[model samples]
Target: MSDPIAARPAQDRAGIRVICNDHSGRNSREAEAIDLAMKVLGPQAELCHVKGSDITETARAAVRDGYATVVAAGGDGTIMAVASALNGTDCTLGMLPLGTFNFFARGYDIPEDPEGAARVIAAGHAQTIDLGAVNGRLFLNNASIGVYPAILKERETVYRRWGRRRIAAHWSVLKTFWRFRRPLKVEIEVEGQRRRFRTPLVFAARSAFQLEHFGLQGADCIRDGGFSVFVTPDVGRLGLLSDALRLAVKQMRLGEDFELICADRLVIHTKRKRQLVACDGEKFLMDGPLEFTMVRDAFRIFTPPPGDEAAA
Candidate 1:
């Protein structure tokens, strides 16, 4: 009977805000995107330019100003900040892929053209998706702690210089596999049961696929409130990475038992106090004693239609 979203009270006016990271290397596109949003969203929409120096503060301020829908326009980091700001609030969330490596955008298939994305936003067919919290930081898509996170932190400059594709996520995934010296030792608990395993990386997927060849469409949708746990145990490192890589690229169905696990919540303990975590595309070092739970139908999103649209 009561409305679930945290911040905004139910009201008549559609309070919407566009939060853009103008520095995402796609500034002109961003400007056009905002223009399209203005046309689509009309009088209710407001566009706010956010500086990188204070992403968190600026995003929250927009919500505080009464934005019922806050569209984050940039790469995954900007999404992280904007969504985290709006978490537990009543405001609806939206995405605009103005940055490199729009993994989150891939989840939604947002039009590469900013104007098209604005049209999708204007249509306002809102739906909900699951979210996760790691040491108080929120994640909308996936989180990986271990070699991937390490590589993300390491290759920040490489990504900036060579570009997102220059140090592609899979490339980093491979580089971390071969170069990382830190052997991963983690104790995992899923659905109240405990198990221990050693792995180079542990990725927590909240309702999405890492790759289409892995039957990514069959992969959980984030709003479903489930996690697909990727475990690499006892497999040859190079061969396993290669297999997973091929599976991803080819969009193949992965072997059931060794490569994946599905659960509603997971608790992970590591030997180190802080482990690197790559959530969606934002990298950070998080405290151990990490717990992730699948949140069913937690937050609202706007996506394309099924069949041809979704497949696109």
Candidate 2:
């Protein structure tokens, strides 16, 4: 197998490149975060304000421009887009976590606030981490299909109407459930074994910290070099709502509410030719038969050192 780590760029020439999307998740504060990052990283660092669709290409351009470190300064979606391009490439990844959830950045012990996160990047402590991929696209937190993607669609609408806030995100979930009607019939294959499931959602999780934070099980499986797959039983709308409530309260039961499948790789097939998939809080339509896999030590990320008081 080819080595996952790419050769680092020459230190003397390569510099830091920070990418931000003001329109991502909660748009208003992204500008402030970008300004703070630039101030912290100094004038030599390059700042690129990119649109959502152009994030990956911009990160690629940063790599081609010989940047040593490319920082994503928005939410999980921005981080995922930048990582999709920089993963297995010469540039190191950094984060500013300027979003509502900021799961990907928090998972790496990066600070949620912009200034603290920027200092972590300035410290330049690099580490290699595993990344999950579905259909050849990388995701830092988790990916899901079925009701979750529908919820993301609703969330976007809600963000536009109510502005971006945690309450708005939760409200969107409630709205999606009230209108939820369909369950997916999928064939999931893992480790040469195949099984069928009728479920409202199939969630594949890559970040153990996210699962643990939500009071969910399967983190250990993720730490063991595999991703955890959660399939919600084909519960009717009311039952699904009940599960959502349980999850919100961190009282969700494992076997009773959802089935958990732990594997290094898996393939999911649906009857539909195309399905909406949500990855790291971004939704998109993808062709069927989604394959999910994990690449261990694949991406180099900038993180704070152990017990770093300044970053904390």
Candidate 3:
């Protein structure tokens, strides 16, 4: 609607120290905007550019070098990388999103434009955000195994190279959704209840599109000591049709195609050798029976001019 207030008064800010991942693939528009942001911050900012295979190392170095704010300037993958690196540390996170979907970015109103996001960072308000983990890895968003992970793997490869060409991303999704190899049969236990589901796919979300983008079911309520979860049945034509409808209308209530739940922890098992799984948008191979938990106020992150700083 109306243009959001871009920045807050400088006197209230907690000061600035930024660490950046310049390696992320981004459109030129976003790049130029972020460059301007860096220039605007001037002496208030100290940026660390990533070197080969050293995203974590450089980020940790920034923290060790006394950076009070750590910014993840790339996709969800980059965000997760930085998030995990800074997890449990005092440095607050700031995101300069440059990913295709930017699921978390959109959910939190983190602007896609670097300058817009930077203005928020300059405001210097910080809040603690929850994170979910599978096995021992940390993820800022949802996680899934089975067909969902497979589709995500394909989506990731194309997205990394091409960015968000909606038609192309959809086409790639279509090519894989129909012919996904080996249906995913999963057994999951949540809050001490167990269920066996034999479906073409499975998704365990810690806050995801409730119905394709009507929005996350508990968007406003998450990080308040509880987390929302969802599971998709399968990926056949009917399933595809249902997903399509969800995309079209965003009717996000619990319906036949979806199962919504809330809990502190969950466990899942699969019969696949390397059950493909995604946490946030990062995908990796994992073995059966995993636990996912919500860590309340896990880490502090910077938000916009509304000022995420705790009220004194």
Per residue, candidate 1 scores C-alpha lDDT tens digits across 149-237 of 77776566566666555336556666665666655888888767888887777877763644442555336534455677777554555
lDDT of 3 by residue, 1-312 (tens): 111221222233343555455656555676676688787566767666674257666666656655667787777777888777777676778887776667776666677776777766777667888777887677776777656666676776776777666655666666566666566677788777888876665555554433236554655334444456566666575566557456446664465766766666878777665666777766777866787776655678877646442211
Overall lDDT per candidate, in order of appearance: 0.67, 0.86, 0.65
Which residue pairs in candidate 2 have backbone atoms (N, alpha carbon, C) closer than 3 angstroms, thus clashing?
Answer: none
Query: What is the model-wide C-alpha lDDT for candidate 2?
Result: 0.86
lDDT of 3 at 222: 49
Write the residue-wise lDDT of candidate 2 on 61-113 in tens digits: 78777788888878899888888887777578999887888988888889887
> 230, model 3: CA deviation in Å?
2.3
Candidate 1 TM-score, true structure as reference: 0.82
What TM-score would every model get versus the actual structure? Answer: 0.82, 0.94, 0.81
By lDDT, the best candidate is 2
